[model samples]
Each structure stands twice: as structure tokens, then as C-alpha cells.
Target: MVKVILFDLDGTLLPMDTDAFINTYLSKLAPSVAEIVDPDRFVKALLTGTEAMIRSKDREKTNEQVFEEAFLPLIELKKEAIWPALDHFYDNVFPTFSYLSKPSPLSRKIVEEAGNQGYRLAVATNPLFPRTAIHHRLQWADVADIPFDLVTVYEESTYTKPHAEYYMEICSRLDVRPEDCIMVGNDIQEDMVASEIGMKTFLVEGYVIDRGEPHYRIDDRGTLEALFRKLQRKEGIFAEK
Candidate 1:
């Protein structure tokens, strides 16, 4: 009954050396907020805020609210002082790092094929960044022009990936059951963990990150080209019996 297909960004939809992009992102981000905090403290505060989001069980508060509660304190500034820097970073700096991500040449085509087959689609990237940042990455993947039923942005999302609630929230919002979705991504832990909530898992190739741990169940594994062909068929992926 797979009514929706959840695609992870960073590695799944937007092919990228995640480590390089993240490191570069960290580097660029530090400079943006240098006036508010030292590079070391800013990174620490940022990671601490991210950790807060991951550890949070509160579904009522958005990740941004949770992040600010933990982050703005460390900088000794209010949201007004810090938001400008972040806004400039995402608007100006973030887009320039497309070099870090490998081109997702098949991204738009794959989504188009999936849509053609009557399946709902979403960009289920981890809800760490604001919508502005996520939207920019969507452009990098060449799928910004395509509409999705859901795009998990930190401003609205209460949880991040790997949490059962995170996947559950999506199903609840989309008005579908967990079993009615396929969570597709390249990460071993963050992406595949969607299977823990009864959603099917598809591990995209060439950007695997299993972390040497016991892996979760993956219903399928292959390149996006392979996925595209699957969509072109009448049976479709996760066809009804």
C-alpha cells in the first residue's frame, strides 16, 4: 500500500560527500557568526543545539525553537542578533557549496517518473536546517521546481531522522500509515532506521554509510536509474497484491 515515497536528501536525493559538505558547511558557518561567537564556541553551540533537537521528545515545539533555546543562550544573544547571520549564510554561502555534492543527475527524472505512476512524494531530509537551507539544497538536486506533498523543514518539524516519531509524524501529517510509505536513502542508520517504524526501506547505492553496525531491513538497493525503471513499470514499487 505504499502511497508515499520518502526520499532523504544530502546522500539520497542530492548525491554529495556528506562529510566534506558538512565540514565545509561548518567552516563557512563559523565565519558567518564570527561576530557573535568564536569559531570554536559557535561550532560547539551549534552541535549542542543539534544534539538537543535529536534528544528532544517534545512534539509540540519545532526544532528551531528547541535549537534556539539551547543555542542562543551560548551566544548570549537573542534570535534577532543571530538570525541575520544565519539568513545570510543560507542565502549566500550555502548555495555556493554545490561543489561538495555530487550531481544528482537522475533526481528530477526519478521524481517525475514516480509522480507519473501516481505515488505521492516527499523530501524527507533530516530536519536540521531551516526551509530556506533545505530549499536551496532542493535546487542543487535539480528538483526545486517539482512540488512535493511534504518537505520536512526544521521550522515545522519536531523531530529529526532515526527517531520513530520522526517517521510517524510524517505519516500522521500525510494521513497515511507507516506501512504505506517507502523511506529511501543511502545512510545505514539515519535512513534505514525508517524500517523500524514498519515503512519499507530502499538503500540507494554509491553513498552507503552503514557505520559497521548491524543493518536494518532494506527492501531494495540500487542506483536511481534502477528506481526510475521500476516506476516506468505497471507493477510499480510496492505494488498491491
Candidate 2:
């Protein structure tokens, strides 16, 4: 009964060394906003804003709103003075980070297979970035063309991963029960937390991040090929549900 399949982008669909990607991303991002704000303060504000998004629990405000509320106050420049720089960075500079993420042909295949089988697809990446940045990363994975029912961007999401509300919100938007969705990701703590509200979970191997014991048993292994084959055989994680 898995009507929706939620895939995490960074480590799951797009293979990456998380730390290397972040370090390189920040190194590039810092200079892009340097003319408007000091590089040091820019990084600090960016990190602070990200933390605010992560810790956000306000159901009424989008993550972007929460991030701006927490971020703008700390810096001297107003949002109007700095937003264009940030937009320019995402449009022009962010694509350079594509080299940090590996392309996955299987990602597009699995998403296509899911869509063919009548399952709704979503990019359930943690919503810390703008849609443009997420879209660019999806392109790097070669799955950007696949029609995803939902892509969790900061402007749309109210919570970040590891919070059950995040999953709940997605389910609500999709009009599907938690038990009828499956979450596939490499991070045990962030992705598998979908199980807190009854979604089935899969743990991808290569970039797996296990923090302590996982909250729920992983329902299946996480290669797109394996998942696709299992679905073909009617033996997918929720096959019996």
C-alpha cells in the first residue's frame, strides 16, 4: 500500500561525501556574498539561519520565514540589500558544486519505475536551501526531469528532518497516511525517523550515517536497483501491508 515514495537527495539519490560537499559549498558560498557582507559574518549568519530552520517548529511559518527571522537580525544589511547576492550565488555559483555530487542513472530509473507503477514521488531532502539550489542538485543527479509530486524546499516546509512533524506535514500535503508512504535515505537518524509516524524506511548503504541505535528496524536495503527489482517481484518493503 505504499502510495508515495520519499527519497532523500544528498547521500541517497546523489552520492556524496557529506563533509567534503559542505566544506566546498561554504568555501564557495562565502565569497559570493562577501561584497555585501563580510565573509565571516555571512557564514555565521548562514549557519545560524540553517540552525533556525532545523530547530523550527512553528506550523504557521515556512522554513524560509523562520530562517530570515533568525538570520537578518544578526547582520547589518537588510534582506533587500543581500537577497539579490544570495540569488545570484544560487543561480551562478551553486552549480559549481555539482562536481561534488556523483551522478546516478539508477536514481532516474527508480523514480520513473515508481511513477509508472502509479506511486507518487517526492524529493524529501532536508529543506534548508532554496528551490533553485535543490533543483540544481536534482539535475546533478540526472533526476530533475522526473516528475516528483513534492520537493521539500525551505519556502514550503515548516520543519526539518528527524522531527516527526516533518513527515506528518508531507503526508498531510500528499493526502496520504503515514503507513502508506516509504522513506528512503542514507541517514538513519534523519531519514528513518519517518517511522515514528508509521512510514516504512529503507537505509541506503554507501553514505550511511548511523547515530546511536536507529528508532525503527530498516524495512529494506537501499539501492535503487534492489528496490526496483523487489517492487517488480511484489516483494517491496510494504508489499504485505
Candidate 3:
């Protein structure tokens, strides 16, 4: 029996103009730290920190720790100085970009559908951002109100996606076997990689992202409505083939 459904936040559930969001994020981020570091250098260092998190396979340090070590020294300030600025950015400026996200009712529909079917849910987004940042995006997706068994955030997550260990870590936290879970997302490479650990994969076609490297099997692919239909089947999509 499939007891859990892992959902990707950005393109899979939330319809986003990724470029627009990133541009806006960078545009705002530079200003947030302009007082402490050269705006251009800050952006460069921030990207480095983010890349460090993505490349990291270190289980001993949280993504947040990895990011801090990589980011702080570049600014020539203690974490205490630059930290509040990023926090302030997420609190004061980040939500304004919610307008960039096209409203998608399907995001909520899928979550509610899975919940009604008794499958546990997770907001399995890449744990690259702080919880508040993720929470804001979740709100923009219109599915923040529902309780999820896990909402992977950088402060706590040791691994980032596209890495099987990341999926395994989530499975470990939820105390569920990978085979008894479904990883649902739009990215062919990043999200579908959950299959490496025996999890079923579902590609959400509404906002498909196929990087074409490290290809993996997806058990199903369709719109969120089709997923709702799958949940309604007599034996459900979990039936062994």
C-alpha cells in the first residue's frame, strides 16, 4: 500500500514563471544585503552557497550550515550581520512576488484529493531555501493550509534533490519504505530520481521540466485531475502490476 505522496512545489503543483521568479528573487536579494557587501559580489557568493548545497553529499551538516559556511566569509561579516537581512527579505519582500505565480487550483485539488484518500502528504520541494521562503511559495500555491507530514527545509534537510540520498532521508524521517511511496513532481531528472530508491514516480505534465540527464522511470504521467482519477480507482494506482 502506498502510504505517502511526495509533491514538488514549484512547477509541479504551483504554476510558476521560473525565470521571472528567479529574476525577481535576485533583484530583491542584492538590495537586501547592499549595506554589508557589494551587491554584485553578494549575488555571486549567494549563488555559490546555493551551489554548495546542491553539490553537497555531507550528512553531518544541514543545508543551512553548508550554505552559511560557504556564504558568510565572502561578505566579510558575521552570520549575525547578514543573516537578518535575508530573513527580512523573506518576511517583507518575498511575498510580493506571489503575483508572479499563476493561480493553480489543481495544486490544492491534488493535495486535498490525496488527503481524502488517506495518503500522507509531503511538500517535497528542493530544500534550498529557509522555511519561511518555502512557506510563502506554498501559500502562493494555495496549499499551505493543509498539514503535511514533511515540508523539507534547508535548516533541517541534509541533502538536496536529484540525489537519491535526499529521497532516502525523507523516507527515513517519515518512517516509510521507499517502495510504499509515490514521488510526484514535474522535473524528469530531479523528481523522478526518487525511483532509484524504489519509490513510484508520477510526472505532472501541467508544468513539465525534462533536463534529459540521469533518466529514470516514471510509473505514471498526467494532469492533476488524472491523478485524482487514479486515486478513485477500485484498487488504486498502487495495485501491483
Candidate 4:
């Protein structure tokens, strides 16, 4: 049975320019801590913190911990200062970045329909951000009722997508096999990699990058809506095969 459907955020669910979000986020974050650490060093520390979390091997620790562990030593700031900056970043800067996102009414409708149909939906967004940040962004898309039974955040996941273990972890947690789930996302390399592990895949072409013109691309949410409805009507996703 196809018990779960995992969706990526940012480009996939939220529909935003990733670079714009980062540039806006850093601009807000930099000035707040400029006095505490060298301006250039602060930026370097922040990037390092992000990278460390990406490269983390300790699955038990949350991403925030990994970021702090990597970042704290470089800045020489009190441990307490980090949270405040994070708060400022999300509070003041994050909302503005939503402007970069192009809203899709059909996207919300599809996700809601999937939840109503009893699919185990999850916002399988990369776990680099804290849950709070992710939660707020989802709200911006007007996607309520966190449809996912399990949400994968960078902190909670030891491996990021493109790594088969990343997809396997969610499948294991949801008690489903790789072939029983579909991963939908805008990035070809990051999201389509799920196919390498035997899961079904969909590419949302509104944001697709040619990058060699990968196969299995769908042009818009209307196509995705059609697919979601078909899956909903199926008795068992793999039964036809």
C-alpha cells in the first residue's frame, strides 16, 4: 500500500527563491551580532554553522545543537546570545522572505485533499531550520493541519535527502517501504534522488531547473492535483503492477 506521501518545502511546498531567502535572512542576522563578533567572522561562523549541521553524523543531536557546537567557538559570544539572534531572524526577517514565495491555491487544496483521504503526509523539508521556523513558513502558504505523521528536519535527521538513508528513515518511521511512497519536490537533484532508492517521484516544473532535462517532470500543480486524485482513488498504489 502507498501509505505515505512526502513533500519538500521551500521550492516544493512554499514556492520561494532559495537564494532570496538566504540573502534576506543573513542581512537581518548580520547587523544584530556585528558588535559581538567581527563582521566578516560572524558571517563565516554562520555559514560554518549551517554547513556543520549539513555534515553532521550525530543523529541524536538536534540541528540547533550541531550549529551551536560549530558556531559558538568562533564568535566568543555567550551561549544565550544565539537564541536571541535566531529569534530576531525568524521574527523580523523571515516573514519578509515570504514575499519571495509564489502562492499556489491548488497546492494547498491538493495537500489538504491528501490528508482528508487518509494519506500519511509529511513536510519532508530539509531539517536545517528549527521546527518553529518551518511551522511559521507552512502557515504562510496557508497550509494548516500538518498533514505529515512525521516531519523531517535537519536536526532530527542524520542524513539529508539524496542520501538513501534519509528516505529510508521516513519510510521506516511510517512503517512503509520505499516503493510505497512518493516524493514531490521542485529540485531535480535533491528530490528526484528518492528514485535511486526505489520510491516514486514527481517534479513540479514551475520551479524546475533544466540541469540536463531529467525525465518525469510535470509542468504545474494542476498536473500534480490530477496525480494526487488518481492516487486517492487507487485501492493499492502498487496493485496495478
Alpha carbon deviation, residue 177, candidate 2 (Å) = 0.4
Candidate 1, after superposition: displacement of residue 147 in Å? 1.3
Model 1 clash number: 0
- Greater TM-score among 2 and 4 belongs to 2
TM-score for all models, in order of appearance:
0.95, 0.96, 0.95, 0.84
Q: Rank the candidates by lDDT, best first.
A: 3, 2, 1, 4
- Residue lDDT tens for model 4, 14-79: 777787777877877788767666768898998999898767666677677888889899888778
lDDT tens digits by residue: candidate 2, 1-241? 7899999999999989889999998999889877778899988988999999999899999999999998898887789999998899899999988888877788787778778888899999999999999999999999888878999999889999889999999999999999999999999899998988999998887888887865566788856667667766668584745
- Report residue 224 deviation for candidate 1 (angstroms): 1.6
Misplaced by over 4 Å in model 3 are 234-241
* Candidate 3 Cα RMSD (Å): 1.6
Q: How does candidate 1 score on lDDT? A: 0.87
Clashing pairs in 3: none
Question: After superposing candidate 2, which stretches have Cα over 4 Å from the reference?
Answer: 238-241
Clashes of each: 0, 0, 0, 5
lDDT of 3 by residue, 1-241 (tens): 7899999988878877677889989998898788888999999889999999999999999999999999888877899878888889899999999988876787787788789878899989999999999999998988889999999999999999899999999999999999889999989999999999999998888778877687999888888777766766623454534
